[model samples]
Target chain A: MRVLGVDPGLTRCGVGVVEGVPGRPCTLVAYYVVYTDPADELPLRLLHLDTELTRLVAEHRPESVAVERVFSQHNVRTVMGTAQASAVAVLAGARAGLPVQTYTPSEVKAAITGSGQADKAQMMAMVTRLLRLAEPPRPADAADALALAICHIWRGGTRARIAAAADAVRQRTAASRTGARPGAPGRPGPKRQGGTR
Target chain B: MRVLGVDPGLTRCGVGVVEGVPGRPCTLVAYYVVYTDPADELPLRLLHLDTELTRLVAEHRPESVAVERVFSQHNVRTVMGTAQASAVAVLAGARAGLPVQTYTPSEVKAAITGSGQADKAQMMAMVTRLLRLAEPPRPADAADALALAICHIWRGGTRARIAAAADAVRQRTAASRTGARPGAPGRPGPKRQGGTR
Candidate 1:
């Protein structure tokens, strides 16, 4: 499965594409960055993000899109702007029908190394090593995006798929018995549709 | 002398007024908190700030207004929003004809306590003791605003005031030289008529 990792921003968005597989190392297929001019209007910057992300998704055909969760408190002003930028990234992923996942910085650092407080330089080095790229990621944003992708791969997303499959089987068994979704303990189960009538 | 400190934000602004002889001691003259609904459009929020700040200036009649300096990482998404908020606060003070001074968080902390890394609660405690307020400033933002005011009071706002005065003098001289009033800097630097003639 191909994965698209995004480090979202209003001005600069870092994008990385990697070939992901459960229980196997993923390969970094390609990466590119998009920058919105600072002089651009706020809404236009968001539009630029949407347009570029749409192109990236179509071009890379990634099966999943991963983004970093918002952390406000760096600065209130900044946090608000980030909220807008992240919203655009979310919308783009949904439009592309790619499953989207968000990882916190701490979670990504923990996944890359054992420490949650790993600095950007450390995280970048780990990402370079993990992806085995011929060259270290050029810009900080690209390395950050790659780190986000690696985090999702390790953070139980793979197990969630198995759990979802198991849940489907359980639901099928329960429906066969009741002809509908299982009812609460005290309730008389969902009433029989045609047969009761 | 009376000092008014402002913790400016797009959605909320916390203002504190302190009055007394700078060397002898100071008293908490008044304090305020205004919250603008973030859901409002950006321009409306800015207009709201203008009205509320004008009201604060009128009611408190502060001789000086101390504002927080925006210091964030060079992240464009964060800095742009902060710059806008800071600009609004600066204009508010200038419009009121009150000398405006700004200090970074560390500057405030260093002035209050002996350390720059002092936490919010520690700063508030010191501010309460300094102003001899009947109660500790309630909200953290209120405490921060008061701290800024206290910083300016302890260290004469000489640095900022001098800079502003110099800027004013420069502008006036240039305007007289060109025989025209002007606007922001990006516009043609006051005409070159006086120099050529």
Candidate 2:
């Protein structure tokens, strides 16, 4: 399966596409860092990320999208920009009907280097070795994009299965809460209601 | 001026529109809370927010958009969701070509109630008083949204002018860096380059 990975940032959004399946070596298809000028307004920067990401999704047609989940950072401004950029990527993936999963930095590192504490150089070296590129990708962001893709390619399928199972459980629980039969096969489940604020 | 205010949340996004110039009493046009199920996937939740906000902007045709700038919260999950939801609102504003600004909660409070630390009750009371509503808007989120709009109506124009001046300074600095004439009228400035990963 092909996966699109996004390392989101306001000024520089890293995007990479990889083709692979579980237990197979992944091949890099395309890599890009979409940039927006810091001088630009927040809305314009967000729009730039959104338009570029949407274009990438349309061009690559990846089966799934992987985004780096934003965590609290000491620099609140940086984290906020990352989160905003990630939201744009997620929106693009949804528009393209691609399943999107978010992987934490540690998760991506562990999946790639077998250690959550792997340093940037180690991860970059591993990515270069894994993709068998003659030279490492430039601008660290590009390497991160590859790592994110590799991590998702290796772990995302299992994660998705687990999520689907959990969804089933949630549906069943919600059904029971609404007085429906618990686990009755072929029961006409009620339609999911839209949230009303 | 017409302003669209967005109080963004993952489960319930509050939106309100008001029409008036600065220093004039603003009139409420419409308010609604867009909702998305928590059980839905993150991508879907973001998509729902994007679509709803875009529709609201189209329907209201606001002259400007205002979003509550997310701050660091103790609840990481809640903060992340809020950040994501706010991104969608910002994107919608950019797409509509409307000037967008973000107001902090305290700033909104200060603008509406003359106190940065005003309680919700005070803010809501002021919203009702200013909008000349018979009763406070329901679901707290709706009231907060009106407060956001009112805040923008009172404070956003000056902020926009300041931001525009900043943009000009940044442009001049960038041009100087590139050896172009500073503020040369109609100078053929280089196009902003996209990020390279």
Candidate 3:
């Protein structure tokens, strides 16, 4: 499975992608950032973000999108800008029909480093270490984005899904021995396809 | 020059890229809609978007990124989503080291149809006609992203800059004959340089 991770920011949005199944190490595919001038009017800034995001989505074609959830910040303007940039991300994912998932900063950090309070540099190092990347992903934002996606795959149960799917098949065989057909009206809850997901 | 326009949204983000010099109607290098599941948490969603955007930017290598400016909408939730998505875009461009530009929805509409209030369908039609695409861009949102890029290129003064630069050269020639040097302490006002913006 392929996952795209984003770190939302109005002035600078970070993006990263990793492709792989869970339990196994994730493959680092790409990472980058988008920058806009806050000095510009809000609408224009959003528009610029939208256009670039759209282009990027079309080009990458990921199966799913992952983004950072905004926690409240002290600055009103900063929060507002962050919120607006995040919208552009959701918009991009939806427009492309890619399943989008978001994780809070703490969650991503915890999943990657076994700690939720990891600082930006710590998160980056963990991302590089966890993914076994060639280097610490340049531009901390991009690494954060990568960490977020890897964290989602880590959380989303890629490995468990596979195991569960196999167990589901095994259960179906056992049911078939007793003459129950798959999806046969009330036949023990449809055997949970796609694995306990 | 290829310019990518993006319309950032949490539900649907639009992407379109026009490849050509200013004044020359651009070709739609690519277009698509990105979608994310509504139930996902915001951070995971952002991560997903970031990953996808990085790949796209790397693939397209657009010289300039054009995106829509966010607007104040009545619904707070809706506005919040839009804002978040927009931030992802800003981050994407910055990471790529590409110059990013923004336009208002009204600015895009006005450029395409001579009206700031042009509807989506109208903008799509005009964009298709202007860009000379094989067909109207899909998902309406993608068309919007494309239109935003076109609008910026049309009015971005890229071509105008070329002309302005030529005129500056002419003025400098004339001034030199009369002994006026730009960027140097002069008999009149402060001298200007023709080189660098």
Compared with the true structure, what per-residue lDDT tens digits does model 3 show for residues A5-68?
8898889999988887776678888888999887885556766777787787788788888888
DockQ of each: 0.03, 0.50, 0.20
Instruction: Write candidate 1's Cα lDDT for B1-197 as tens digits.
Output: 78889886655677888876544457888877777776864444545665687788888888878888765554545554444455555555655767787788888899888799998778888988998876799787788888888888877744546666777777777666555534554444553322211
- Per model, the share of native interface contacts recovered reads 0.00, 0.79, 0.45
Which prediction has the highest lDDT against the true structure? Answer: 2
TM-score, per-candidate, Cα-based: 0.44, 0.78, 0.52
State the displacement of the C-alpha of residue B82, model 2, in Å, after optimal TM-score superposition.
1.3
Clashes per candidate, residues 3 or more apart or on different chains: 0, 2, 99
Sort all candidates by lDDT, best to worst.
2, 3, 1
What stretches of model 3 exceed 4 Å from their correct place?
A1-79, A82-197, B162-170, B173-197
- Indicate the TM-score of model 1: 0.44
Docking class of 2: medium
Score candidate 2 by DockQ: 0.50
- The candidate that wins on DockQ is 2
Better of 2 and 3 by TM-score: 2
What overall lDDT goes with each candidate model?
A: 0.71, 0.86, 0.76
Interface RMSD of each: 11.7, 1.4, 6.6
- Looking at model 1, residue B112 earns an lDDT score of 81
Model 3 CA lDDT for position B41: 60
